[model samples]
Target: MGKLLLFLSLLPVSGLAGEPVALSEKTYDPSLGVLIIQVNWGRTWKCGQFEHAQLQALTFTQLPLEGANSVVLELQTHSQIAAENTFLPYAYVVQPGEYQLTDFDVAVAKSKKEVIHLKGAKEDMAKAPQSAGTFTIQPGEIVYVGHFGLDCTEEPFLWRFYIEGRSEFESYIAGFRQKFPFVKEVPVQFKLFSTQRFGNPYALENPTVH
Candidate 1:
């Protein structure tokens, strides 16, 4: 999908066939599958676009298409319009295949200071990366992949990304269904698992391609 845009190129590696992709409801076609998900920066995005996130999508081989990591090609941008739970919706167009969230970027402060969190960020550290649980996407359907949130509640604040559960689905999906009438007839699945905060969002690791 040439329309895909990769915002921040954090690292350099071998090239991939396709560029990263993230689409809006206006740009989505009825033929392709629609993946709708959301993320909360934990706090308000006072700094605006400075706080960035780059999601990569890899081929079935799971190899680093761009470099060491594939791309999210999902909703990496924050919505000026907030949804339920102060979350932002990301609508991604995906081909039929296995996809993974190998790496993602999140902000720790009010500024656009981003930290790259590799799935297995630091081998030595006991904390594992939050599992980007698996699921499938069928053509012309809308899939709700649950909500992901960043919470820095501690005194100094630790950036953690969590996969919120179904309790939130009803609230979010209910609101989403009303906003995008196009997806009203589409089938949806609520299979969001424990995409817990495990890996070191603050640390970086050497790139190791599959």
Candidate 2:
């Protein structure tokens, strides 16, 4: 009984106190990296509509590529929120290497209820112009790419999309990390391809001067 009491006393009285500190040390695979694709658009209609439009349809028609073949990575939409309150899509557990962002599409509806039906009827949803971009990943690093969707505030509402350059992409990742504390902040350099799908047009987009 004396030995039992000694062992018990050795245990830290505040056992749970260390949990948050332990969790602060985020764990990541040494051989893998993460790729986040952010799609920011007008959630609220410019019209007098109070409720924001629902993202009815969105998908990577062409996912990330390692070389000539598609990389085996699981893509998740709405992975997390950013400082600007934008939802982001990400590819998780990606092997450390260079990858090209191939073709992608997104569709938005006025209401969440309509989005459900629009998902099944993809043909019915308005799609953003497809774009191709690229970025690299080092072991235990996280890289980001940006695609913008602009929903104009007038009739015949159209959603226009284009890839953002490197500086802009870096700025976004920096802002995102400020709000999302869980993601380990790793400096990343990205390249977006403009002309030649995979081999030709890949480099980070420069932030526009506007």
Q: Which numbered prediction scores highest in lDDT against the true structure?
A: 1
Pull out the clashing pairs in model 1. Answer: 13-67, 55-71, 55-72, 56-71, 56-72, 57-71, 57-72, 128-198, 128-199, 129-199
How many clashing residue pairs, candidate 1? 10
Clashes of each: 10, 11
Model 2 scores worst on lDDT over the 10 consecutive residues at 1-10
Model 2 misplaced stretches (Cα beyond 4 Å): 1-27, 41-54, 61-91, 97-140, 148-185, 192-210
lDDT of 2 by residue, 1-210 (tens): 000000111111111211101111243344466544434432545323323443333333223322354453223233222223243433344556654333333334445455311222223211311223334566766554434343435421223233345454545555545544566345544533232221233343443211
Per-residue lDDT tens digits of candidate 1, residues 120-139?
Answer: 22222223323433445556
- For model 1, the superposed segments whose C-alpha errors exceed 4 Å read 1-26, 42-85, 109-132, 153-171, 193-210
Superposed Cα deviation of residue 163, candidate 2 (Å): 9.7
In order of appearance, the predictions have TM-scores of 0.48, 0.40
